[model samples]
Target: MIEVRQVTKRYGTKTVVDALDFTAKPGQVTGFLGPNGAGKSTTMRMIIGLDAPTSGSVTVNGKRYAEHAAPLHEIGALLEAKSVHPGRSAYSHLWGLAQTNGIPRRRVDEVIELAGLTSVARKRVGAFSLGMGQRLGIAAALLGDPAVVMLDEPVNGLDPEGVLWVRNLLSGLAAEGRTVMLSSHLMSETALIADHLVVIGRGRLLADTSVEALVQEAGIGAGIRVGSDAAERLRQVLAGPGVSVASSADGELEVSGLSAREVGEIANRNNIPLYELSSRAVSLEEAFMELTRDAVEYGKVAA
Candidate 1:
């Protein structure tokens, strides 16, 4: 498990991460989300001991990353995919990392096959494509067979198949009761795999909740889309305190603060004919935007 407690970081006069606190439990995929310049990278750096926290502490597997006798065996991370030497082959790069932490040569072969880099295992790193580089980075992260896995934008430059493979791999890791924390801007993909989310903005914690709970809290697209010949009449009937009825240009009514059953029963009592009534489930992207709207540092100015 990974625990970040009241962690803060600073550079010169700027604060990058501010009192951030969250726990990534084993047996679940926790998505770490934030906008650009939101201190996510700094926070990840602190977790892996790449940078010291100005305050508070970050622990992986119940101890500081540097304190672990075999740090790689405790937590494996992929912060940068292109950190490898260009002159080395994929197999050589992984082999070198394994040697540093006393990892076995067989484990190096295992991760190469697991990451689907077997065909290009002997290819020079400088000749590999972006997708292949990402695959190699992932292979390095799994080289230690660590209890905790952390990856940032693991799907970057990946094709649709590679994306699916990563989704399944993270899910499988969580199933084995490992602590899996991944940072991604792809909300749709994150929603499909992450059991929990840790969202930050402007160096502060914004949300720590389940996937369903966060979207529900946003209340975007949480209304019922009702279509009827008598839309105006239906709107009138549905109008009351605490209930909202909005009409679209296409003449459909979006009714909120009421359930589908409640709307149907009310319409039935009023003899309003309805052709369509369905709940508009909010997407994860919509919820993330709503929650972080005020925290965006480089927002576009409206004309």
Candidate 2:
């Protein structure tokens, strides 16, 4: 487990990350999400103690990272893959970390195999492809056999197979009751992997909740489509309570909030929709957009 207590960071006079508080629990993958210059990196740096917080505090398990007796065994992080020495082989690099941390040298080979870098373990890291470098970085993170894993953009450069491999690896780690916190701007990938989401905007907490709760809170329910006079009638029936009704580009009624089942119930109850009725939930991408739309610090203007 990890706890961030009112953490804040500043560079000069600009506050990059404001007072934010959240907890990352074990047995789940928590996604850290934000747009460009939204302080995602700064916050992550604070979490790992790479950058000191101007105020507040962050702890791995129950203590600051530097204070932990065996930091690697407590928390293993892949904040940036390029941090490794280019000239060193993947095997040697991990060996060095294991040696310094008093971890068994045998763990290096295990991580190499776990990350699918066994074939290139002896090759210089600089010569490896971007995907290979990412795998090597992951291998280093797992070398300590830590309880908490933090990965920043773990899939930044990888083939489809590598991407799937990473997803499975995160799930497998979390299933074993280890805390896994991964940061990524890719909502689709996060949606598929994370059980919880910790979204930040302009360095402040936007949402800290489960994926299912976020989808429900975003009101992404099945959409209703109707074109007959029943359209207006069905609209009225769906309008009550928490539902939202709108017209699609094709002139079909789009209803959110009520499920297809409930929409069909109302339609059948009113002899209305005989056209189209299907379950339609808003994807994680759409929900993330809605959540962070107001928090983007910068964006390109329309041409």
Candidate 3:
């Protein structure tokens, strides 16, 4: 597990991360989400000790990352995929880290296979494609078999297959009771993979909750969409206190205040022939945009 308590990061007079507090728990994938300049990278850097917190603390398991005798075994991070030496082969790069950390050399081969880099394990780092480099970085992160894994934009340059692989890898890690914290801008992919989310905006915590909870709280249930030959009759049937009915260009009804089941029953009772009845649930992307709309710091404006 990773715990960040009242953590803050400042540069001169500017505060990038404001008294942030959240936890990345074991047995789940926690998504760290924020827009550009929202201090996500800064907060992640503090988690791995790449950057110090100006105030408060960030601990992995029970101690600070630097305090651990074998930090790799506790937490493995991939904050930058291009950190490897350009002249070294993928295997050589991982071998060097393993040698320094006293990790078994055999683990390097295992991670190579795990990250699907076995075929190109001997290739030089500088020659690897963007996707291949991402795979190599992930391979290094898994080399130590760390209990906590933190990755920023793990699927950055990945293809569809690689993206799916990452999703499966995160799920597999969390299933083993490891802590998996990932930061990504792919809202659809994040929705599919993450069990919980830690959203930040301008270095402040906007939301920290489960995927289901966030969607529910967003109130995306735009009500049931109904299609009927007797659209006017259907609207009347759905109308009541707190109920609203609107017509679409396609001659269907967008209804609120009544459940799909209730609408169907009402239509059946009223002898209204219906063609379609479906409940509308808010998508993760929509909910995310709604939550972070005000928090976006570097958004573009349309002319």
Q: Which number leads on TM-score?
A: 1
lDDT of 2 by residue, 241-264 (tens): 788989878767877767777778
**Candidate 1, clashing residue pairs?**
none
**Model 1 ranges off by over 4 Å:** none
CA-lDDT, candidates in order: 0.95, 0.87, 0.91
Q: Tell me each candidate's TM-score.
A: 0.96, 0.90, 0.94
For model 2, how many clashes? 0
Worst 10 contiguous positions by lDDT, candidate 2: 220-229
lDDT of 3 by residue, 55-103 (tens): 9999999899899887888899999999988999999999999987899
Any runs in candidate 3 off by more than 4 Å, and if so which? 240-242, 265-271
Q: If ranked by lDDT, best first, what sequence of candidates would result? A: 1, 3, 2
Clashes of each: 0, 0, 0
RMSD in angstroms, all models?
1.4, 2.8, 1.8
lDDT top scorer: 1
